[model samples]
Target: MNLTLKIWRQKNANDKGKMVDYKVNDISPDMSFLEMLDVLNEQLINKDEEPVAFDHDCREGICGMCSLYINGEAHGPDRGITTCQLHMRMFKDGDTIYIEPFRAKAFPVVKDLIVDRSSFDRIQHAGGFISVNTSGNTIDANAIPVNKHDADKAFEAATCIGCGACVATCKNSSAMLFVGAKVSQFALLPQGQIEATDRVLNMVKQMDEEGFGNCTNTGACEVECPKGISLENIARMNTEYLKASLKG
Candidate 1:
């Protein structure tokens, strides 16, 4: 297959960025999206041109680092798939693909297709963890008898990989789904109960401080999320936030 890639290129954060055109020929449908980009970059290198800069790690789609906006979608046209998991077979020959970095105020473009996502780490650091004693053998694994339903829900919430696709797809650039997923993961588990209120409050506060917009219930975040984090997690966070506000 052959493709015309209109990729965003910026020398730096302050540099004016624009979509630059390039062509890739004889791409294998079996190649992963990142692999196709690799081929393109190799071609650019041989021609002595600066290659496109994008993020990728564990191309198996577990790392969630492969952030790209392909053809105006958060992770391309496919549903519930990350860029690393996307394949060339999804596109036809002679297709014109527009590639851009994950767009959001908090995720400013660093250069080309790369954006600084450290803001997500700052928000996670704010309250995405439980303060448990690291003493050896503090409690048995079976000490907490959590309901099966809650355990499953917590596990589902924990599947969130913090990819920021939710923000990119959301009209408001909301991180609520991501934040709610993290909060719900612990809130549903017994070990997370100790710092439940503080966890939710602090994370939500930090999310706001990060300049992430409000959740408008557009469902775009949930739909674009690679992990399929449910909107119910947002509801849970709201309930928790209400209770925390009332209790204080």
Candidate 2:
């Protein structure tokens, strides 16, 4: 199938960017979205033009690096899949596809579809890990039994890949879902009890410091999340945040 692509082109973060039109032909329905982009880049290179700069790694959709706002939707028109997991069959021949970077104040445009998502790194660094004794005195993993329900919930929350789709889709550009997932992953585990109070506090503080927006219950974040990170995680995070605030 042939397609028209209106992709955002920016030389650098400071440059005022605009959409540039291009055409691709003979696209296969079996091709993943990134594969289509790869074809497009190849065409550009053949013409001695600079290739479009997009991020991708582990294109199987695990790494969450292919973040694109396609046709006004995060990760294209699909549900519960990242851009890398999206297939060209979703579009028809001669369709016009608009591709742009994930937009958020914290995620400033770097170049073309690339944006600075390191804000997420700062938030995670604030308090995403549990402190443990490294002198070989750690408790046995089997000694403490966790509730099956809570363990399942924690595992679900742990699937978040920090892709910023939540932020990109949210009207407020909130990181509540992503941050909540990180907090819930640990808050449900006994090993994370040691830093529960400080973890939520510091992470939330850093989320705000990074210029992420507030959660207004729009629920778009959960829908676009490739991992299907539940809104329950956000609720859990709110409860955790409240308890931490009261005790602090």
Candidate 3:
């Protein structure tokens, strides 16, 4: 298969960028999208040209490092899939593929197809963890029996891999869904309630300081999220945030 790729190229965050076209030939349909780029990069290296820079790790979709905006979608044309998990078979020969880094003020491009996502790390650090004693004694896993329904909901919310697809897909580039998921994961569980008020307030404040936009109920974030994080998580977060504000 052959493809014409129009990819965004930027040397640094301050540098002017544009879409540069390149042709790739003999790409296998079974080749993963990142593999196809590897082939293209190899050719560019052989010609002494700069290679395209993209992020990936574990290429198995667990790391959430393969963040990309392909052909106007968060992760190409595939739903519930990351760019590294996207296969070339999803396209046809002679197709034109457009690739861009995640477009957000918080995710400025560091180079071609690669954006600095440390903003997310900072937001998570603001309050995404539970404080538990690290004493050697192991407590029974069921020591505090939680309602089965709440446990299931917390587990579902915890599935979020912090991919930032929600921000990339949101018209406002809101991080509410992602933040909501994290908040919900702990808010519903007894283990997360001790510091719940502080956690919600701090995380939300950090999210705003990071320059992320507000959620307008567009629902695009949940749709593009590979983990299927639900809009319900956002609703849950609103309640948590309100309760936190009331108590303070």
Candidate 4:
């Protein structure tokens, strides 16, 4: 298959970015998107041209590192998959692929297609954990029974990979879905009860500090999330925050 790629090329965050056009020919439909890019990069390297830079790791769709806006959609034309899992078969032989990095105020472009997503790390550090007394005796996880429904919901929310798709797909570039998933993961557990108040407060504070926009319930984030993270988690976080505010 022959395809035309219009990819964004930015030397750094300070540099003016522009879309560059290139053509890849005889591509196998079976090849993953990253593999096709690897072919393109190899071609450029052979010509002594600086290869295109894109973020990808563990192409298995677990790490959520492959964040690309392909043809105006987050993670290419596929549903429920990351950019790394996207294959050329999804496009036609002569398709023109528009590739760009995930755009958000919190996510600054680092190079061609890599954005600084460490803001997510900082938000996680703010309050994505539960405090446990590990000094002495350990409590068996099975000793305390949890409602099957709550556990399932928590597991669902925990599937969020922080890929920033929620932010990129939103017209507001909101991180509510990401932060909601993080909050719901712990909020449904018994161990998280201790700091529920501070957890929601600090995490939301950090989310705002990172410069992510506020969610206005457009539901675009839920639609584009690769893990199918629910918008219910955002509602849960809002309830938790409201309750915490009332307590104070």
lDDT of each: 0.92, 0.95, 0.92, 0.93
lDDT minimum window of 10 residues, candidate 3: 132-141
Rank the candidate models, highest lDDT first.
2, 4, 3, 1
**Cα lDDT for residue 8, model 2?**
99
Tell me the lDDT of model 1 at 144.
Answer: 74
Give the count of colliding residue pairs in each prediction: 0, 0, 0, 0
**What is the C-alpha lDDT profile of model 2 across 61-167, one tens digit per residue?**
89989899999999999899999999999999999999999999999999999999999999999999987676989868669899999899999999999999999
TM-score of 3: 0.97
The estimated TM-scores of all candidates read 0.97, 0.97, 0.97, 0.97
Q: What tens-digit string does per-residue lDDT give for candidate 1 at 1-248? A: 99999999999999999989999999999999999999999999999999999999998878889899999889898988899999999999999999999999989999899889888898789889987766884666478799999999999999999989999999998999999999999999989888888888888898888899999999998888999999999999999999988876
In the range 219-244, model 3's lDDT, one tens digit per residue, is: 99988999899999999999999999
Measured by TM-score, how close is model 2 to the native structure?
A: 0.97
* Per-residue lDDT over 172-225 for candidate 4, one digit per residue giving the tens place of the 0 to 100 score: 989999999999998998878889999999999999999999899999888889
Model 3 regions lying over 4 Å from their true place:
135-141
